[model samples]
Target: MTDVAVPPPAPTTQTRARAEVAVAGVRVAPPVRRQAGAGPSDDGHVRLDGRGAALPLDPSSPFEVVDGRLLRDGDDVGLEVEAVDRPRFYDLATADGVPYEQLARLHGTDVLASTVIQTCIRYGEDDRCRFCAIESSLRAGATTRVKTPPQLAEVAEAAVRLDGVRQVVLTTGTTATPDRGARYLARCVAAIRRAVPGLPVQVQCEPPDDLAVLSELSMVGATSIGIHVESLDDEVRRRWMPGKAHVPLDDYWRAWDAAVRTFGRNQVSTYLLVGLGEDPDELVAGASELVARGVYPFVVPFRPLVGTLAADHPAPDPAVLAEVTERVAAVLRAAGMRGADQGAGCAACGACSVLSTAGG
Candidate 1:
């Protein structure tokens, strides 16, 4: 029999990816301020929820917002966007005078996000990851080092009540415990479930030394998990995140295996940051390995944040970002994984990535 031919995906998907690249890699110009939050966007950014796009509307970027719709350099890009007001939850404070905004903040379109432990064990001058700005917001007093379960629960309830948030993503700085702060995540998940029983919550952390916490998380009502390995290239990991690199690749594989077993395929994921001086071809290969293990590689173009060693470094070129997204999106499609199917978390949020738009 003759081999079957495969038709390409719709052009709309590729077009979406290109738009995402433009938003992510380009800096918005002056006269435009980011609508809210400092965690990731660092400036005025908006999500094209209906069209499945998220981009920063900055001076340097080709995309802009005019009157209530998004345009590509003064032209309609067949996408619609509304200026999202600052989340209502930001205006409230915890009973003890700790602002709820400091406890947890809104991410993307409808996801409530928090870094449960804001300080990282590996964040010291010698051990810190060059690309991480985890503590910049913390030192800036934008957040607390740790969030109590009660505080998170309260914040979660208000976020959903005030802004209609649909999901929650709880992440933490890596701590010294063998659980790698997984236990706290479990507690936070349990608390959030108690407060919002029907809401889905996802947890992110370094792979814990104890795999049992993986099951504990699943049992406690966590809908998904992100065990990020920024770069698959060992050398890149060493140069960028020296401390995490010492953990070894085999350990990460072991963790991925356990996470997949516990959370199920597509529910487990990792962050693959490009432009860390790693070979693009190798980056694609690494993403492929992740897909083979039933893990969704949440590819992010590296952006040098405010206080990291790589703060002066530049983001990846749009062409490189486009290439990686298209390649990895294919892997996800073949594995039958879609970020939206995961129900909750960063991968589910899908704004920071182009894979979901590419039909992954």
Candidate 2:
């Protein structure tokens, strides 16, 4: 996925105003470094540009960085944004020394990602998820709550040899174990595919009351799986996730029909957030019936992060996130779907949704 040459996209109303100016922000200049947990909320971080777009800004975004590109009050949205650096395996550490940025971080613009169990059995603020900040970066120490699997294959072989990255997302947190943690994410995807050979991972967890733990995470090497039911409106998942709205949406359609028969059709995705009070025509008629059951309703747009419980609340109305991203990008383009045509995580890293540049 790195031969380059991308460009012919923009214009779904300027890609919904560059994805609502990456969740309404553009006053930047410094202190970017952000990306809290369980995914989606760009209060700060992940905005790669170089023609492939990644989106997630607003770390106080006035969108500066002029000469290298992306200005604002001075205009020039002529492309070329910034903000996704900080890798180089975050200055290395592990050998049991920890601190490979607390065991994995780099998401979007090279996707290393990890939360391999940063504590949750629905973490308590009366069963969390009121827009989770997933342990607020493990209570501010920044990270590390349980990594392992050979410290995630020694930080995925030094983040694909010092940040050429590529793929791997992991994601955890509902662990009371019943394979709910998917057998330790199938032993960390068989120790990161025996220490990073083919690379493509994706895990994400939460619908696992067995069903062979989604075929043991596609026989251990993962390739894809999200299962995030951020909102299917059973009263907006019992008023914003009271312990994952007490499970049963027929167990997320029986784990989305055993994860689309074990990660096939559009490789099974799910995460339909958009302003959680729901009813954007019932969230596009429940994301067009989870895209007619092949799933991939990733629709995200409810950012209120800072230690969450809906932070101070407010960030989901860039005109209803461009009318729910043009009605879920026309149900991921009449279900031909395309978050980079998935072979990896988070709708193939369409970095917090513009639905892959609104072409879906």
Candidate 3:
């Protein structure tokens, strides 16, 4: 067996517990659970100490929730665990009978999110991101292949009316067109904004060939944008996200710069997942550059979900995750950038990552 690298110790007990539970998971089952889809995949939504947290429910884990507190080995871990109640909007359906749940689902407590296009061009085995299950939910019939702008608008209006959804997140599968699905996302953003004026909405997509689409999204009412690059290391990208790696880091840099210019500093974000064989120190440095360039590097641990190429891979060491998160959080703090300041999207929601807990 390969010797596991021992990560540096966590900065605090809370950080250590958060990191341990992030990978080992907890035994409690949350009411709102996300199985597999465009990810931060395979987790249950709950509030950890009154803050949103998406944690995996691994039966074998030592952690459990009792008396509204997180416990491990029969001792309180100083963390509260409250399952997010299922939203009222989930009960409604469209006029044509498509269930509202099929359109969009609640993330954390109030963030409504959907993958507008449930399929992707790079979903083929060889080119797929090793950690992505972007199409598995589609194949399982949990969601539709494509969601029209009106359908999304109708759902968004009801979600806001019935459940008081605070924000919306719209992401899509990478398409073959030059816009790479940004144009379609723009149209969806316009429809949702038209339906619920001033509701914060965040749109996520690949770096499009046309940077103009970035401005178009902002003009139409996107509160923020996430051009997720999962990893900044070239080798890690090529090995884990072969198809996306083809876009080149320069493309991501250009898109991030354009997005920052359009959406304003700290309004633009990207995913910087821990693990995936990236050098932890280098990863933190890259995140520093991103923060300096006005990009929020939303750091998250890599979960090995059920329906992905890396399903069998182990999660990063808790100590390593916590150490990395603490370091990245320092950089974000130094730059006066925090995920909640983004107003919408994953960072604002702050469930999938422990960065918020680290004060990022």
Candidate 4:
């Protein structure tokens, strides 16, 4: 857990190979050998084949891509681009006219993630999380309004069989219930596990009113759970997630404690996003507290994804991200935790966080 400073260097072949393995993209991690080409532009972006071009490493730039790759000064540097080809399961449909792919989308090589309920109770501008585009994909008709348990089972089975998917992540928009959206997620988990026995699945939702729902999720074969409290600061929570902020921080702590007791240490985690105007020290301190509580803090940079309120907003500087990542990594290492060891959830896959590079 000792902090060790490693000097930053240009991307090496080994580092590139590891990055390709982590991202699981065809352009970046092709099974067959392929040429890696780079072309410089006047604006400092470098074009890579199927993979998107790189951006400057400056943390102040609002421009960023879905892949967690960082860009600095036009040179690719630490960024690695990988193109993920469409999975075969996307072409199939259920008996009831539901497209199988809508049930879940492929993330990397082994992860299947779904927004189980496309509808959100807090979709309004006043209450919605600035970073969320929960219903945008649904409005665009890219996903079904709601995925039936049977429909999810069909797609999960197909994804595991055809695409070699090894884990599943089920997230839902908050609903008006004591259990929040955990009940529906439990049902989905049970159905998917029934269809594909032994497939590790993670369920994510707001902290529910009933802590016992954690046990229900565990009993239903959910290997992990994510109760995302994007920030610990009350003001930051209020500004970024007005609806969720109404639920006190005490509620999150109670839920996280219950989940850890039910799912075991390292099985419970939360998303602590950077770039929400919270002090970097607060993030590190909050993450350290979560570690002490046996909760893995999934530190991800705040990307202003398209279709969200923050779309026009700028992201934190890459240097800031790197700094926060190094600090959180120390905490995670001290707690004997690593994202890959979680078995499921975003932390386990870690494409969204640079902390994984520091061995979080």
C-alpha lDDT of residue 52 in model 1: 30
In order, what lDDT does every prediction score?
0.76, 0.75, 0.90, 0.71
Task: Identify the runs in model 3 with alpha carbons over 4 angstroms from their true place.
Answer: 1-10
Reference-based lDDT, residue 20, model 2: 65
The sequence of per-residue lDDT tens digits that candidate 4 reaches over residues 10-86 is 44343343233222222222221211110000011222322222222333433233354533333344544544456
- Cα RMSD of predicted structure 2: 18.0
Between prediction 1 and prediction 2, the one with superior lDDT is 1
Clashing pairs in 3: none
TM-score of each prediction: 0.89, 0.33, 0.97, 0.81
Model 3 error, position 283 (Å): 0.5
lDDT of 2 by residue, 263-326 (tens): 8877888888887778677677777777777878888788777667877777777667666777
Better of 2 and 3 by lDDT: 3
**Could you tell me the TM-score of candidate 1?**
0.89
Question: What's the best-to-worst order under lDDT?
Answer: 3, 1, 2, 4
lDDT of 4: 0.71
- Which 10 consecutive positions of candidate 4 have the poorest summed lDDT? 34-43
Residue by residue across 216-283, what tens digits does model 1's lDDT show?
99999999999988888888888989989989888898999999999898899888886788877777
Query: What's every prediction's RMSD, in angstroms?
Result: 4.1, 18.0, 3.7, 7.7
Cα lDDT tens digits for candidate 3, 249-312: 9999999999999999999999999988999988887888888899999999999999999999
Candidate 3 C-alpha error for residue 304, in Å: 0.6
